[model samples]
Target: MIRKLYDVIVVGAGSMGMSAGYELARRGFKTLLIDAFDPPHPLGSHHGEPRLIRHAYGGGAAYVKMALRADKRWLELEEATGEKLLERSGVLNIADPDVYSYEGRFEDAAVHGVSIESLDAQQIHERWSGVRLPDHFRAMYEPNAGYLYSEKCVAAYKKVALQAGATLLTHTFVTNIKPEKSYVTVSTKDDEFMAAKVILSAGAWFKTLEPFVHLPIRAVRKVVGWFEPSGKSFDAGAFPGFTFGNASGGYYGFPSIGGAGVKIGRHDTGVEWRPGEELEPFGTYPEDEDDLRRVLESFLPGAAGKLLRSAVCKYEFTPDDNFIIDTHPEFSSVLLAGGFSGHGFKFSSVVGEMLADQVELGKWGQDVGLFSARRFAQEDN
Candidate 1:
């Protein structure tokens, strides 16, 4: 059956889409949040026990402003849900002096006035003596940056969205979107949706949406895993979460949230991937296990006491690895929040607000001019 009309239709109701739906519904709009699965599922990207929520964007300083506002919204959601979604235990970034992570993040802190502390290798060893660190490694500590219960956070938004009169259709895979001058026609296997506006937050499926809107997003499959740290001192407190970058590789992870282990994964392990193909096969990869073992062997052997669990998630990567949150080229009715590149979870809250404005006011107040689809047409990535 075809739905008669909707103010907004959000595809892929995981973190960002659900939050947007919740916001729209709260604003007295008839919103629909559709998903391929019920969510909090293994097939899609927004899983795992927890995710690191760091401020002081290593990506750039412009993101810092957005992140600060987003951080506030996360706190607001936490208050609404009455669930502790974020942990302010802090984030430790370990890298060399010349590396992008250390120096850039340091600059971000200075530029944005975000609280940060730069530490020497000895200082890092002193502050957290539980794990091993290289002698030449420098560290930047952002006290506001910590971890978030990502799946639970999404679930909270979904619950509130339903409460606000938003309709959520689970197991509805959106196959096509055709835009008319008036509205967009969205189709799924079981039903069709007609909405005044549409938002494409379909995560890894961003590439497939290019025909609908020319988004220069490449979906890449990346691995995240938890390790059973043998030493009790290797616990969460003893092991403040971190994002690392070096000439060899960069990675990030949470402390022992599962109570039995420390979780970690390499950021750049994904060579290019095609969706539904290598994005996420039916199960884990043997080479994935070998890769985690290799990383642990190179970095923290104690935390890698056991590969307790492992899985893969796809990151919708833009050429510049930044997000695209703006209207489509030819259609004002279709909005997009694509190419998160493994870092959009933290900004989901404020991103929803921006998208809501795009649907209602015809433009967002924020300076997302950098996220335009036209950027791809230029030479720079």
Candidate 2:
């Protein structure tokens, strides 16, 4: 027997899914959120303590605008829920001139009227003594950017979504998704549930639904670690969240908030992963700590004392490192949101709003043309 659940069913209530569920339910849609594990859990990508939120995105014009919308929505959510989900710690992006470029970011910021301060290596060092950069390095500081308590954000969304009359099923793994002509059936171990519309934001687990919706998304194992700081300057109040880009790769980090130490993670390079497979422990690979340590030692030596703790997460990547936020080609009722690459968490708020907009209005409210899965059609030929 199929239990017709609600107006919409959100699968994989992680960062994007949780926000989507919250938006859908709060807007008076009966929503059901099904998750394999209790959300805000460490098993997925959103568990890491803090994720960066930047406004002057280097990605593109649409990204910058989307980011601004997301920033507004996040603040609104915080105000509505009375939850301290975001921190206005600012963001600093440094790149070696010879190795990389920040021109695209500056252009995007200019086009969007986002404030970005140009800083040379000396200025960066003076502004944040903990940051040690080469004389040739250049930087852009977005004063309005900061970090989000990711897990807390998800938890808050879940709570508010439930209060808004959304049904949540935790620790229940989805076994299958069958999209019919008019409705979709989501099957779990215990029962089959049907909904008129569905939003799929399953992160790495999106692979499991290949039979119902095929997206060119791949999961990659990534790691992040907290390190003991050698000085108080690396504290959240004194230091800003930062990103460093060079010829080798890129790394992102946060200041020590609540004395949790400085959190650091490499933005590029990780092992390809599959669903249901175990992600080796953080230290399983020497580079997990060593790679992060090398960046800290080079730039923020003050924050490179020792490893406080570490965790592994997955990055659902698309072929072009863009995002896949479009409807399933086969089923218009099923909205697909995945392959955020690594910089997706910050936009969860707005992405959720757009997903819900697509369900209710037959199209995304924002200009998500760049994220259309149809862009991959050329590859098929």
Candidate 3:
């Protein structure tokens, strides 16, 4: 059988994979990106129209640099493609005043020089009349951080990657991967292709792929809902993207952009998903709408009129929610970039650059030790 060859083969042309292909193609590498479905499709995490981009990362202080870099790249892409990709609506985080609900977020902002404003509940309610929080809850507002038009961002990357000489095979599923001494072979049932290097970024289906079977990641199903607002107070132009959290749990949301209604979703609620199975629709479970309704009724009662629309997606989570963007332990030529958990779509641009740097220079420009897969190995000892 004949084998087609390229400099890099990126499996899973969704958010990270597509961006990596774009970066590699721009660097004059012969790249091929193969995906099971057309990207920016409704099946993945990047499907939702908008994704919040916060520089004062709640996850850890180490992420602020990557988040800032990703923000810059998003703006650069918007300028280059002339696409309306980022919505600068700002982001407001509501939590208890005394308790640091968002771990390391304040420290991250301080270390990165990212500006943020602290507001008490009364001040928050006064500024955004639609929001009603308990007096004990305080807020940290990042005026410069906002939400991205996620689907549009993926579409733009796909377009420019092709323009930069990258080849993409959409609706083509990779059945197996075999790493060799000099090259890696990717099989798609009917054909085989070889590349000098490969990026295994299969997202939610990461565990189902070979050479990654025991990668200690799980695919989980998640849902988000859009509700009709009672008035124009919830309009995207006037309202900001927001997060509400405490000792109980956390919920994140976006304002009604383009009359799409106020979109909301719980951050930590996810049901384990079996790979290769069709995703259950949004309303399959009662909590899908009920959980979101509970949040809206408690905080933004004005925006919880009726359920306008809903969608389901997947999240690939590691034991710890941090991402894993390192080389495969056994294969130097195969890079692994998955286990984003959640809160990763915002960093897709910078992550792609990091993976590209790893491919060409064999090292990342930034210290990504926090995301290394070896952390799990170390924990087991």
Candidate 3 scores a C-alpha RMSD against the true structure in Å of 1.3
Q: Which residue ranges in model 1 land beyond 4 Å of their true spot?
A: 278-287
- lDDT at residue 328 of model 3 (Cα atoms): 85
Error of 2 at 334 (Å): 0.7
Q: List the residue pairs that clash in candidate 1.
A: none
Give candidate 3's error at residue 75 in angstroms: 0.8
Candidate 2's C-alpha runs over 4 A off are none
Ranking by lDDT: 2, 3, 1
Better of 1 and 3 by lDDT: 3
lDDT of 3 by residue, 147-255 (tens): 9988999999999999999999988888888988899999997889999999988898776685544577888899999999988999998999998887657889999
TM-score per candidate, chains pooled = 0.93, 0.98, 0.97
lDDT of 2 by residue, 69-101 (tens): 999999998998899989989999999889888
Q: Please give the CA lDDT of all the candidate structures.
A: 0.79, 0.90, 0.89
Q: For each candidate, C-alpha RMSD in Å?
A: 2.2, 1.2, 1.3
The collision pairs in model 3 are: none
